[model samples]
Target: MTETAIAEHGLIGDLQTSALVGTDGSIDWYCCPRFDSPSVFGALLDEHRGGRFRVCPTGTAYTTRQMYYPDSAVLITRFHAEQGVGEVVDFMPPAGEIATGRHRLVRMLRCVRGRMSFGIEVAPRFDYGRRAHTTDVTESGAVFSAGQLALTLHTVREPEDERLARVRVEDGDMRAGLDLVAGQVRGMILESGADGPPREVRVADFQRLFDETVRYWRSWLARCTYLGRWRQVVARSAITLKLMTYAPTGGLVAAPTMALPEQVGGERNWDYRYTWVRDASFSVYALLALGFSGEAERFGVWLGDRIRERAGGAGGPLNIMYRVDGSTDLKEEILDHWSGYRGSRPVRLGNGAAAQLQLDIYGEALDSVFVGDRAGLEIPYRGWLAIREVLDWLAERWDQPEEGIWETRGGRRPFTYGRLMSWVALDRGIRLAMAHGRPAPLERWTRERDAIYEQVMRQGWNEDRQAFVQHYHTEVLDAALLRMPTVGFVAPRDPRWLSTLDAMDAELVTDSLVYRYNPEASPDGLRGQEGTFSLCTFAYISALARAGRLEHARQVFEKMLTYANHVGLYSEEIALTGEQIGNFPQAFTHLSLIDAALTLDDALDGPTGPATGR
Candidate 1:
């Protein structure tokens, strides 16, 4: 089985798409055109068949370290050898308000001490390595062409005053050998397109791009109002969230790469390149907390469009997820041509849960709308009517069994988290009506919301466990319920919530890490043992802080920080060995991290312990 430590990587993006750069100086995973597009470099999943681009020291043994540039998405990977130190700076120039088909990955290399010899390799595997590509090499660089898809690599040397490097094409891959002395710099730009002709770029051009990318990031982060103790970490999370967002439509993907295993050698690998309603809604809250009201408002508009598009359709209120452009057709397929990550079989391409009746989305969607409205984003009259209709429709159907928050294929059960979110939807909707003086079925919403609360308190609670269970029929306690306080469903210090936290701490937590639930107690229709969920871990910290357990919360938060990759990026899960697992650079994890940091910071600063926003 081919394997690389999942945590040994950093992320760079242009808002529309992202790439994963391994610590060994290889672009292991990159999807062209867009986040959900076909992979141009899929070596992260199948090392043998999927292609990669590597630039690293070829003549010296070295130790590697990587970090992001302060608050920016730019990543720097340093190689330390006995005789010299070298670094590669990786970043994609941020695409402004305009949408375009061009996407570029820039790599700048320099030797800071002594001397170092470096090697470069560029291999392209189009359409997930199912098609063969032809490479044409010239004095400028090389272009790999497969049908309509083409990737051009442009190389630039310092100047005539410096020693020049030699590049050769071998075995359908571009190879380059260069020796750099101290303060010497070299660069390469990989551009993907259908129309752009291959050409050589000047060092001055690359210098301008680098400077502009840096300026863009610094200016963007300057808008942040978080002057808290955890500012650096919180800012990093914000930048990650921004990186994972689809700039054109303001849709936020759960993560950039897919088919990464939740469990090594397990069949739980999934595609998370699509936008999830639950994740995007929580992201809005995190962005708002960081004083990015424009992002929250734009996302609110996208979400409202989705709701309006599905209203009165046969598809029911809304699907759980959608394509970045709000399309609902996501056909899941297994790629039998490639070996999965770490030999985790059955690599999947698209999400099958898009059509699942995950009713919790309505609650999350309404909550986002409520948050946006509070942040002064106006809701159109038509938008309000569409939201009102969904709430009324939900009142009649919230009691039914459907796919829960986890989207488990085992079977639909009345998940308590689903019920809690349903109540949230109605509650938020009613509040919005009152706050905006909009026409709504206020009495019906209130009655349904109250009924949901009473039913949950009565049936969802497991008397034996002394906590809210995962579903009506199961004794399994889910860490997802950690959001109860944040959503205003229950007081953080309420006995019921405290009991739930205690139960989870005993059952689901391992050294401050949190498992979503015990699949042994409740099978999720997949055969695999998984890692502690990163998002759930953050939720646990937030809940603990809100409950006045500041010391416990602070300690857990600090430990969780250690789990982040060298560049402050987090994946979907963290293994028992403290390695990251599943789809990398997860937006859900980063957003939750922001929420947890903000909640904990407020608690630490205030005279009273964390206020639960009730």
Candidate 2:
């Protein structure tokens, strides 16, 4: 397989799970059944050991390009060779309301202008390439089986044609080739965990599924309420967020691919296939802003369950993150046998940061539920009581310090952002109780909230630097503090905030890209360094816009959009070289983009009204 750049890929998924298909015509990274499940194809991390399903034109020198079927998750990768032009359309049918332990990935090949020969390979590496698998190739397709995982690949063509008849098995993998002329087509459908004979799909069946899938995506996107500027980009981000959601439980994973490095040949790699409270809570606000109340309401129920499970128990109100099914057994493990992306070693599965103490989550959780409630998602009495219990639990322990939002392994300090969130948690909880006339302890919560405000103003501020430091001990600026204005903790144009923004502009912001924090000044117990955070950059744009710097904000936002990949997708971070790194199609980045776009649009319209009367 040709080496593919991380930015040269498009994403496709059912509501349950997603796959990353490269411009090179390879399904390089995919997890079966669920986003957190083991990989059926993972060549993005290790090209040799990590298996992949590749279908590309062979014996031809070609340049490739990729794009989404407009307003849909269906991805098309087009190949242009000396003799002809061909393309592959990839998609996964929507799982809809029912939750299942099975999934299907379809790839259709077409020669639009001339003749081209295509080669196909199916290699399955179960359990992160730690387990072996056996393959059976028949005339029609192939079946691959491991201990508990089975995948069947079906061929689709005209009954009278011989498009996929050249099947051969080699070294536990399946390989085949086919030739097609202009106006001819062939298809492949790979389904997970099927019983009895493999399901045979003809050309007509492929066309039916394709039409249904396209309709499903277009119909779903029609519900978006964002009619402001950047409509196309906002719609794409919304679709990406929906694709990351596990429809069964209404849980959203942070990203589909894991262990993509923050820095090439660096150890700053971690898994992001679990839901973080901070990420999901912010997602609720983004979804609600776009009129996606159903998603917000469902996430509210999922979050309410977490609170109820721990309302009367020990530990904090919630873990920093959780698995898709609301299970907390995310024990981190390292794949020592496989080489990491670009040799960034110790490719890890499961996030160890889930067990850390991050006080900011309370603020995020309460803020989400509060937003959902305001959007007409009613909080049942029992759920309200559980939320009250969580506030009560949080009120007692808001003072202490743990790892901050960055989840650094460095020892904890008095993180100012954490304190800001602690204040938000109490303030929102008190407002919820008062607005709905629910029973609660408002006096104690209000007192604590006021005290937290005082404490942050005093200790979190550094008089000499004229900026709020990352923590009490150091005079370092952090991009995470850009949310101070967005969360209502401080005014965007307040003298202090403007000064802090100026400080960050001098230190953290580079050509409009913002770094999370300077690790050189505040060593984060981790080796090497990282790139500018895409989420932080978007937040910076929001802060700029809210501060009445509309022209500058528009400039920064436009520049940031240029960093997005060809299909308007972003990874977690952007390398200094201007390429996307870290996990692909990150929810945090997309959500923040949506927020920034809305904020900028509102700012550009001024006090009269929105430009589109939205």
Candidate 3:
């Protein structure tokens, strides 16, 4: 079988974990129980060894089209054949405020018109396809068991006379053949670790689950206050971000899948299933802007707990990233058993960069708290103290650097973006303290904040390059610095920032798609090149809009939208040929898309000139 394009997938989740369903009617990637758990179906990364659950027309020439239900995460894939048209509805029942051991994937099929014949295939590979599993088939369903992990597939077909032999396991995998006329419905449920025998699924039961799932998503989206030009696209981006979040701890993973390479057949693949402070912190304002204050509030609480945990220990202020449960240790490892996506080898898990000291996180963490406060979420006094201690520690250590925001293995330098965010940390901290009448070392924070600003302006800027460079000594421009205006580090219309933007356009922008930095110009320890970053492109659009280039920003934003997948989903990066090249459905990219839309809407609605920076 040919490999599926990374962009040709839609996401569906229960707010705890998500699965990627391809346009060809296959659940190729899914992690059971939790977002970071080992995959039960991993065909997205490896076609042969990694298993898959697929439902499609059999022994016929069919054209496939996939789309999400309006305003919901329910995915529908339609197959048009000479005989008839068949549709498959895929979703996971919403698990609201409750965590369960059992996770179910419900796939319902219907012959919308004429007569259609469809086939079902189920293959389960446990422990990343390293463990072998035994399949057992019964009258009503089939079970694939490997150690403690077991997946049961239950099916029901109409006419009430279809024999069990039609839906039995064949050659170690569940195989089903169904023939249906117009208005006939067939249902299948694949569930993880149930207590008793698989229940007999009925059409009515499938309808109830589908309705409830739709209701859960539509109700959640009803809270959005954005009545803007890009309402539908913005809502889709918001839903994608929400799907990437782990609901239990309020921590959002960068993406659900691991080791989907930025550069195919390169060593750049790293696990993005862990939560990064930088990504989540940048997401707060976007969440709040869409009236999702509850998500922002939960993230603030989760970040506060991490702050308290770090402050109580002898370790530094914070790790760059953590597991969804707020655990600090994420030891990176490679799974050598299964081949990577398109031969992108050394599929990695557990990011090693978690232990690196990226100083910008303090600024991002404090900014998240500030944004949450603005959204009417309050922090406890102890949480405030924890934040205060982080600022105090930062005041002393901001000048030093370990690793930059990109988590480049190429040693650390005094990154200008890192310093810019440090200024943001103290700046926001001082404002929050005075605004709330909270106890903080305001005088010292003020001095440190001003000092850092002066230091960055003096050393970080390069007169020759006519821009704020990537690091203190290099003349390379970084797309990450595009946030300088959005974060209030520099005025949007400041001549210096304008010069920086122009410089970036010359070096980093390729027809409005932005690369993080040119690795050849400023070598980060990595060996291969990467695609243009989606998050950075959105940031570029936001910066352009805030700078009062409304028409140009609008053009860029619309062009970037065309780059999004068929379902309005974005991955971490886009290859030169416009293929999505990194982890699919990245939270950072979607959140930045929301921020860009909000910024552009505000710009288009407001006065013509750039506003003064704070």
Per-candidate local distance difference test: 0.88, 0.89, 0.87
TM-score, one value per model: 0.97, 0.98, 0.98
Clash counts for the predictions, in order: 0, 0, 0
Decoy 1 TM-score against native? 0.97
lDDT of 3 at 203: 79
Per-residue C-alpha lDDT of model 2 across residues 407-500, encoded as one tens digit per residue: 9999877899999998989999999999989999999999999999999999999999899999988999989899898888887788999999
Worst 10 residues of 2 by lDDT: 605-614
- Best-fitting candidate, scored by lDDT: 2
Off by over 4 Å in 1: 158-166, 194-196
Cα lDDT of model 2 overall?
Answer: 0.89
Which pairs clash inside model 3?
Answer: none
CA displacement after TM-score superposition, residue 58 of candidate 2 (Å): 1.1
- Selected candidate, larger lDDT, 1 vs 2: 2
Ranking by lDDT: 2, 1, 3
- TM-score of decoy 3: 0.98
